[model samples]
Target: MKNLDKLLEKYAKLCVKVGINIKEGQPLVINAPIEGLEFVRLLSKNAYELGASEVYVNWSDEVLTKLKYKNSPMEVFENYPKWKADSLEDFAKRGAGFISISSDDPELLKEMDPKKVAAANKSASIALKEYRKYTMNDINPWLVISIATRSWAKKVFPKLEEEKALKSLWDAIFKATRIDQEDPIKAWEDHMGNLKEKVDFLNNKKIKSLHYTSKNGTDLKVELPIDHIWAGGGSITSSGVPFAPNMPTEEVYTMPDKYGVDGVIYSTKPLNYGGNLIDEFKLYFEKGKVVDFSASVGEEVLKDLFAIDEGAKHLGEVALVPFDSPISNSNIIFMNTLFDENASCHFAFGKAYPTNIKGGEDMTDEELEAHHVNNSLTHVDFMVGDSTTSIVATTLDGKTLQIFKDGNWAF
Candidate 1:
């Protein structure tokens, strides 16, 4: 009917065609916030046209969860719905592909305890991992993409009405995913190629240690092992070929040395947790392990997170993101690390990256611990990126090389 409507329709077609690779006679699963119901309906029509046998949608809302936070007992935080686990298991068993749209209310969980939030996150991931092992073995396809919902869209542009805000977010999402490109699939191919170059650079450098510094929080240095692989470009096909993870992703990450990190760092953005958000989060690290943490708004939650297990305090991801990203250039404060960390470099605590370690699963706990690859169900990423953030590499020969300055690549 209109240019915008045509674009929206094309975007939906692209998602189903390229993003999900919809197949005939296959069942489709969609998980989105209520604001996405309209788009989900549109997708359902396209899915059915492409021979989808069934299209199931799970519409979510923060209001119900808000009600729980306002009324449920504190102990309810530790519990999870059994049906959710069962459903995911069944989906995996049925060889169904999943497409989850993420547009979380960044501040909704600001008041919740970090520990409870971490526990809940860990529980879901553990169940998903269990299901994934079976699904991945069979090469059952799945895809996840974050769409801007009204609640989150409003947070991004406070001045705009909810509908306009949602539209603005949609614009950004489409642009970031290269949906505007004349050839979107080709754009991804080139983008992934650039990431491969970065990964190759890190591998060739053979950096033994990474050093970081910034105002208000960081003076951290971590020793990396030789086995650690700098991973990006989503990952590989079950057959061990490369593929994209998220459409807009541009990051090169590695698993950090479990016992080789030392410093105190402040999170650049607030973290959404449980049903609350934590801000002004500061953490102290000793030998690649989080020894203590504090957040100005949700200190209680932070404490609970550290209590999950001994390995919960360990670091999982260490990623590098250039400051010149289109998102960072907007100078918008997202308050959501999932989006913000991509604006600059960041790290995470908890579960190690399986791909980073060689034969990690077969290794004994003692052997794994020796390499600083501890096992934990919790892996939460936080943004430590900042305007003055700088990173340098030190070779085993004591040669120093500049890696990043003001969030840009120095190499």
Candidate 2:
């Protein structure tokens, strides 16, 4: 086995230096899954070494969530803990660096209620939207990464033994996140430079609309905001401090007009909601709003999510991940949206991106509405890539150009 201790130390240092850009005397907050305990602990130790004032680790366990699903009452799902809400606010006000880790056991929810799972996860956020708003606004720097647990490693490599699978997945994630470079920081700088090129090209082209079509789908016409900034690779908070968004990412994304999307789209991956798995879901949109949705499983979860608020039904993030992405080349269907979206192009529902739109967050509700900035606490992403799916940009000058062909970037 590779020296796990050394790996943890190296990973933590990278997170502090490159991911979160930990500053002296800065407070740090980690929302880590139990699977990531080792990395979290090492990160805390590193934070102290970096002169952090305090390091808070908020741990979550899928087993605990499973128990709640099996035992908690329906009403209990709606109410959130006041302390938890306060904690999010505290982190935001303190300008704490937020780091999140994802390492879920894929089969844990194989038999659970997808709707109930979705409800449980969304309940806390809906109850704490204000604090979430602060974090989303990049009140401070933030970083997110994934760890390989026994179960997650199993999901990634079903044929291998636990130890081997873990090593393999670890190698994959490390490489994908650019942790193996001789100078990883410089590697990120170069990668972000390439992403900036794509964004700059799109921004300069003044693309006014996006049109998409595939075999069973032929229905989305999206309007892009004038002066919108296409962001990808890494992002700085409103504070001008840089941080990594996705652990292994290759996408330039912008917010879509909440009221400007029209058509039907199919989900390319299974969704985990309310501790249950929802599969084969299809959504129909009308005038930038999700008017209807259906799934072979967990339809109720989607219904409840749509009922959250007007903004919940609107689109938030519109991202493009090329078909040749490393994760995509793995050719393994994780059945999880996060990994699946990283493999290919995807979009989200709810909570618009402030950086994507010009003056997005500062705009009044009226002003934002005019610009089609979607608003909601629930931002859910789903994959939509297919071999025939393509994207075309309609320039502001009324010229049409192909940007992607068969799930690949044309530029």
Candidate 3:
């Protein structure tokens, strides 16, 4: 018990020091599940100790949410509380750093209607579009980290008892985030440097497009926009504050032109979307749109996912993760995108981050649209890389360079 408490404290401190890089006098906001309240309290304490002027928490309960979904009318799903949306906007306006703790059962909403879930998500996103723009543009630092709950742990390690599974999952999370290291902050700094090196290498190549192929029926071509930037590791906010958006991040990604993707790709891992598991899925793209798709499970959910908005059918982000990442090597199916997406190469459908385009943060919506950047209320990532996959880059100068072979960077 003592060791567990110590681990949680250390993890919270790492989040405060490195993940959000909380600045002196900065207000901090955390969105976390009720199951993660212990860690949230620790994080709030750590943030205050690190010079945060104030700490705000937006606590959520999965059971309550499920009950609401089950009992609420369809019209309720369409309404997003203005007060909640305003609060998030206010946080961005005040330059408050944001931290989100993810720890929900993957199947928490499996019994609910997919359309209603999609409606609720879409409505909320629309109501908070301004807030989304602020965060997506990196106006303020934001970090997303994960915690282990009993239900989530059980999903991961079904064979183990509840207590044992929770501990095992916690151990896995700590190791993946390098929190198990003697000096986790220093370890992260070194890891960030290594990732930056890879980004620099890709940027120097000035590739105009990428071609992916595998024996698993993936033959895709993704065109990169002019002045596109491949970003990962730590990112600096508009005010020059540095923060890591996702802990245990292994992918350096860029936005794919909204109208520039063409191929048929198969998912290498299952995607747990809104507590629904989508597996054995394949997407057929034409001119950057998902013209067709099929999934062995959660087919209705997949259909509803792409129907969120017009931009939902277009590609937003293309990320490259080595097939040999620490999380992938662990041989654990977390059933969570936060960890699973980092385990393999993936692509997102919906809104693209403005930071991925050159001078994009300051660009007008029209300008961004002209640059072929996607804009939508949703961003869903699905794994698509494995040992059988290979990626090659085609430079503007007509040079073909190998990027990945057998799912690892070839360089």
Candidate 4:
């Protein structure tokens, strides 16, 4: 926790300069938890210093959100306010740079009715469908970063008191984002360069499919779309501006063919979904659909997730991360997808990113579906890789190759 303020100032600059890479004349919109007010102020100041046209912060407090769920009738969760959706559309149309400060309490809604949570989630996703396309398609810049809150920090460092846990969690976050280093931006450039190497390799190989096996009883294979692009480290806007989507990203990922997956996969870590944790889950797939599934925890929530839409039962993304990755070495479970998903190999259910496929940007939703890309209202990621995992690829040459050995990338 030494130099906490100094580290935070550096973090704010990094989020503006490197994370979202805000353009000079573009406005910035931030979605932040009230607990992160101090950091949000710093972030807005940095954006203004970089010549951002304006800064808007949308404050969210989970306590109020949970209160609504507790007191509102069932019908209340079934509909979302159209005015809020329209406001987001207005921002995206003006080419706003967006940042999300996520400090989630892993078990905040543990005792809430799963049905209510599911309904609210579905309604919001439906209403915001248009606004989501901008970030999903890389039409505008977007980034997700985190700060430590009492509940979230305690979840990560359970044995410590509130203040101690906050300090420890902040330390973990700084190290993960390299904000603890002398020059975080330069460190990120070096990290992205390494990720670019893997991207270039995968693109050059023209891989057909990947076969995976692990000690946790995972034996699955997922095929790549004909023109799928492997992307990681950074992303570019439709107009050519570059930005990093996830501050501490370490995975190279692409969409998998919606109809070309088979076998089974097991979760290596708890999946924190809508404040509920689904742990020790096993999903069985056949020809790309999740035919059967089981979870030792939050089974009802898992069911509601799959019920979101037909595409929810199919694979949208396949990502690769080394077992010896920095986050993995830290031995801390942040219980947040942005952090945990980067710690190991993972897969997403529901919508596939439009930018993942060649010419996908201009293709209509129907066209994308015809090309075998899964589409849904939600995209949820869960970890599955460990040191015992191995992935074999069938290249364009029609032969088996080792893409991953012992959970790390293999030449």
Write candidate 1's Cα lDDT for 1-411 as tens digits: 376676667666666665666677777788888867777887788878888788887777888867766677756656666777687777766656567776788777665544556666656666556665533332455555667777788888999998899888878877777777777767776887898899988887778889999876588898887677787765654434333445557678888888888988888877755545667888888877777777888777667666766777888788988888866776776655556767768787676765676665456657777777756756667788777888989976789999889868887
What TM-score would candidate 1 get against the native?
Answer: 0.86
Residue 331, model 1, lDDT: 76
* Residue-level lDDT tens digits of model 3 in 8-94: 898999999999999889999999999887899999999999899999999989889999999999889888999999999998999
Ranking by lDDT: 4, 3, 2, 1
Model 2 segments more than 4 A misplaced: 113-118, 216-218
Error of 2 at 250 (Å): 0.9
Global lDDT for candidate 1? 0.72
Kindly list the per-residue Cα lDDT of model 4 for residues 1-411, writing each as its tens digit.
348989999999999999989878899999999999989999999999999999988898889988987999988989888988898889999999899988889998898888899998899889999999999999999999999899899888999999999999989899999998999999999999999999999998899999999998999989998999999999999999999999779999999999999999999999999889999999999999999999999999999999999999998899999989989999999999889998999999999999999999889999999889999999999999999899999988898889899988887
List pairs with backbone clashes in candidate 2. Answer: 113-276, 114-273, 114-276, 116-274, 117-274, 117-275, 118-273, 118-274, 261-288
lDDT tens per residue, model 2, 212-292: 877766557888777677888878877788887666678888988777788888877777544446677888888888888
All candidates' TM-scores?
A: 0.86, 0.93, 0.99, 0.99
Model 2 per-residue lDDT at 125: 64
List ranges where model 1 is wrong by over 4 Å.
13-28, 42-56, 71-77, 93-96, 109-129, 132-142, 361-370, 396-398
